[model samples]
Target: MKTAIKICGISTLEALDAAIEARADFIGLVFFPPSPRHVDGHAASALAMRAADRIGRVGLFVDADDALIAEGIKAGRLEALQLHGEETPARVAQVKERFQLPVWKAVSVATSEDVTRAESYRDAADLILFDAKTPKDAALPGGMGLSFDWSLLDGWKGRPGWGLAGGLRVDNVAEAIVRTAAPLVDTSSGVESAPGVKDAGLISQFCRVARAA
Candidate 1:
């Protein structure tokens, strides 16, 4: 199958358009307040409207409450919910039931054990996003241009609903795909000119590379 691409942390219409032009399979709108890429309901609503059905909209939340998730879903018209926090398997199942949308649980990987932990969410999560684990003092959980050892997933045979994230750039995305055999590759800071500032040219290049890989 062709590798799918997700351009995440899109907070502006320009970035959203760039992802659409790049033919990204999914575009993430962050709801986390602490992140530089954070987007409010009004902003997400406009972006979602502009997106229409051109691309899948995924909402990124960090241990958010139902009220916030509901607002984001309505505003962003999200097709999927990416939980990038310490949410457990039960919590993952709960969120899926309450929202009736595909729920993605992001597992921060640093070692083989971290990758193994994702199995617990197989029954609950619609997708398991394997992201690089951040520092204890880091302000954000992801979109920090950090990556874990790709070899850790060399022969992964667990749940098939999984994707790779973190530290992916246009220069290395092809290699990442070849190395991990990731069905879907997600990026946020990789195509950005600065924190939360996406560059249209870079977005196009990254998608092209992933497709060709």
Candidate 2:
């Protein structure tokens, strides 16, 4: 099967076009204000309209309230939500029930115990995303270009629909997929020229390599 690719943190029309043109299965829009890739509701709406149905629109949030999610859904016409916060399983269920959209809960993994925590969200989340753990006192939750050991997923058997994230780039993504057999992969800083600045060539290369892998 073809591995799905998600180019996260797309804020500009140029970046959006790159993801769509690259044949990315999912395009991520950050809703968290603290994130460098964050896009307001107005900008998101325009980007969504520009994308139309060519790519799957996903809104990334971190412990966002209902009003924020509601606004993002309406404006961006998001088809899925990626929660990368300290939200509980109950919150995931609540958001899924209220929004009626697929919810992907991102679990921070640094060790075997961290991988086990993902099982709790199997029933609540539609999909699970394993991301590298960030420092407790870090400024942002993710997108710091930090990566955990890929071998940590060698025998992963938590949930059915899951993906890999954190420091994935064109170079190591093929190796990552070969090792973990991840059905989906996500990237942000890895494909960026600078923080929050996406490179079209890198986006294209990432998709090509991931697809081949």
Candidate 3:
């Protein structure tokens, strides 16, 4: 099967189109206010409607409250939620059980030891995204455009599907795939022109590379 593609942090029409044209399997709309990629709930809902089943509508959030998560779900007919904050395993289970939507947990990886926790998440999450660990003082947890040691995933063979994210781009994505053999990959900052600004050309290039790989 072909590797799935997820283009995240979509905040514009052109960016949305680029992901669609690039044949992305999913498009992510961030709802966390601290992140530069944050989008209004209503806007995200509108965009997801426009997308209209062309791809999975992903709602990205931090350690948001139940009200916030509910709002996000109602905002868009989201197929999945990416918990990008410091959500515990119990919290993950609660969100999954409450929403009955498949949950994708984003785990920060800055070293090899981080890989071991992947399985614990696998039990609660339907999918696990390996992202770079952000600075402790960072305002937000993710979308930092950082890259961790991909070698940590060098021989990672675990249960549940996984995605490679953080600093993924047109140039390095193929190399990432070769190294991790990730069945799916997600990108946010990598395809952007600036903070919260997605570039269509980069989106197209990224999808092409992921598909080709």
User: Which 10 successive residues of model 3 have the least lDDT summed?
Assistant: 153-162
> Which candidate wins on lDDT?
1
Question: Candidate 3, clashing residue pairs?
Answer: none
lDDT of 2: 0.94
- Model 2 vs. true fold: TM: 0.98
lDDT of candidate 3 over 43-131, digit per residue (tens): 88778778887888989988899998899888877899999988988999999999999999999999888888776787799899999
* Alpha-carbon RMSD to native, per candidate: 0.7, 0.8, 1.1
Name model 1 segments beyond 4 Å from true: none
lDDT of 3: 0.88
Tell me which residue pairs clash in candidate 2.
Answer: none
Q: Report model 3's TM-score to 2 decimal places.
A: 0.96
Taking all chains together, each candidate's TM-score versus the true structure is 0.99, 0.98, 0.96
* Tens digit of per-residue lDDT, candidate 1, span 24-108: 9999999999999999999999999999999999999999999999999999999999999999999999999999999999999
Q: Give residue 68's error in model 3 in angstroms.
A: 0.6
